[model samples]
Target: MITTTGLTKVYQSRDREVTALDGVDLHVREGEVYGVIGQSGAGKSSLIRCVNLLERPTSGTVTVAGQDLTALAGRGRRAGAELRRARTRIGMVFQHFNLLDSRTVLDNVELPLEILGVSGQARTRKAKELLDLVGLAEKAKSYPGQLSGGQKQRVGIARALAGDPQVLLSDEATSALDPETTRSILQLLRDLNQQLGLTVLLITHEMDVVKTVCDSAALMQRGRIVESGTVGELLATPGSELAHELFPVGGTASGPDRTVVDVTFHGESASRPVISQLSRTYNIDISILGAAMDTVGGKQIGRMRIELPGRFEENVVPIGFLREQGLQAEVVDGDPAPKTPAGAPAATAGPAGTTAVPEQTAPPVKEAAK
Candidate 1:
């Protein structure tokens, strides 16, 4: 539904030129949620603004629903009409609630329709329906100052949809709220996306937000997309920095008798009992250090750390077996020895010495598919 080719945006200060975007190419398929994540000054906000020509790009082209936005540079009434029509199809929700204190909840929701010239009866019906959809039907008469943060944001969502837009752009919408509120808003967004068939372009710095709702996410660094894919694929690529940020590994206290390794599971392989098999096949005592198992996009996947025996040398064979089964296993630098223990210390060493591994992080590599 949305496509950008070599999209570039630059800003000129009094003394210097700042390139907010540098020849970035991106495509978002219809009816899918695409997530863009990056550190500060990564052009995430600039990209979202450029999608609707809110911030005109320095060069390149943007096409949405087959309309060339860059070419709509007309003047007077004609340009205004064309841009209005385009914007009506593209909705945006800001991080700040952006509601008027003087307006009631229903009034805030109805403002967009008022701007599009939607009349009295039609606007009232649509506004009530949207408020109901967002579960704020009773708040229609209340002003923005009276509502909670989540409620105010719901009003924003309802207002964005007042035009019945095909594409919805979210700009760090949950950055201001607490964790519980953030989860609630994320669930609301997922529900709306599925129910309305709206294509969403969500921009956020939080990895949990992406993990909770996005089908595919791209990591932006310094005005460019460094990595992009399904979350599972990214996680399985050994030491993917994007995946690491999404699901971080806990610390592993190294001992004299154990080794640490990081393992990734995805697709059909993610469902198998490979961890148990490692011990059963090699007769190596394996102790699970730390593991995180979750279903992303309804698919089961896992990232785990297992400890091997300190005497475990020559991991080429066991690691090879994991690869043969279509799993990603990386031997990290650590010893599973207990604190101040030689042989059979209070640490117990868990199982066999063949595997003593803690789950500390490893260098990131692009995970290969199952």
Candidate 2:
């Protein structure tokens, strides 16, 4: 329900101009969790801010829920009444739970409704409902200072929902929480997306966050969108950086007689016995170097690094065999047919199709999958 065209944002200084977003085009479908990921300087924060006009774009458009936010926000830095009204339909969650310490959990949730001129009784009732929805009803009477980090975030989520927003923007909301808490918060967001039909736009530097919750994702680099697609589409793509980061493979050089091949599994292929079938068909033993299996968007997705008892050229037929079974297979490392005079096979690194194991250790595929 969100779309941007030529969304460019530039910062001006005395000497130079810096562009946080350059000709960025984005589309987030309704009721889906779409993640925008990048490093510290990737302009992810700027993009999220611009979505709600928190950071006005130097040029371009921002449209949400069939309203062109750029047009609603006239030429000034101050927000007009129209823009303010439009913003009420959008909710935002921050990395640091920005709760008023003096206010109780219930009041924190009620703040948004209060701003909307909701009556005291109605706001309290609505706040309680939101708290219950977020599993924080019991903490309604407690102050923010008394709650744990996760609880505070839960309060933040409850407050964001106070306005009954159709769209939710999460700005590193779980970055400050621990891993377990992060998972819980993400699950909560997922549940909200499904139950309330809330369309979520997530900004995160963590790949795991995207892997766990995002239905689709886009990678930002140097103020530009380098890649964007569904999780399975990206995983099946050849040399997809997003997919490689999603399932990192440690590459280790094997003995001269073996060739390393990476096999990518998506959807139904993930359930098939392709590895064993390849061995039986080709009459070659396969060694599992590493594997990473993950469930995203209710689909099984994963990658595996395997070693064949021959050079890469010799195993071409087997790699092709994997492709016929709806799997992506690529040569990770190995030599041509002829071995070097020193009896050492020349190392060849191809595009990544699976997570590579570290050179120092061969972490078993099962453990790696976990």
RMSD (Cα, Å) for all candidates, in order, is: 8.6, 7.2
Q: How many residue pairs clash in each candidate?
A: 24, 4
Give the TM-scores of the predictions, in the order they appear.
0.84, 0.88
lDDT per residue (tens digit) for residues 271-336 in model 1: 888878767666677777788877778777777877776533544446556777777766555444
Best prediction by TM-score: 2
Q: Write the per-residue lDDT of candidate 2 for residues 79-103, one digit (tens) a residue.
A: 5778988998899999999999999
Alpha carbon lDDT at 305, candidate 2:
82
After the best TM-score superposition of candidate 1, give how far the Cα of residue 353 lies from its true spot, in angstroms. Answer: 24
Q: Which residues of candidate 1, in runs, are more than 4 Å off?
A: 74-77, 250-259, 309-313, 333-370
Off by over 4 Å in 2: 75-79, 255-258, 333-370
> Candidate 1: RMSD over Cα atoms?
8.6
lDDT of 1: 0.80
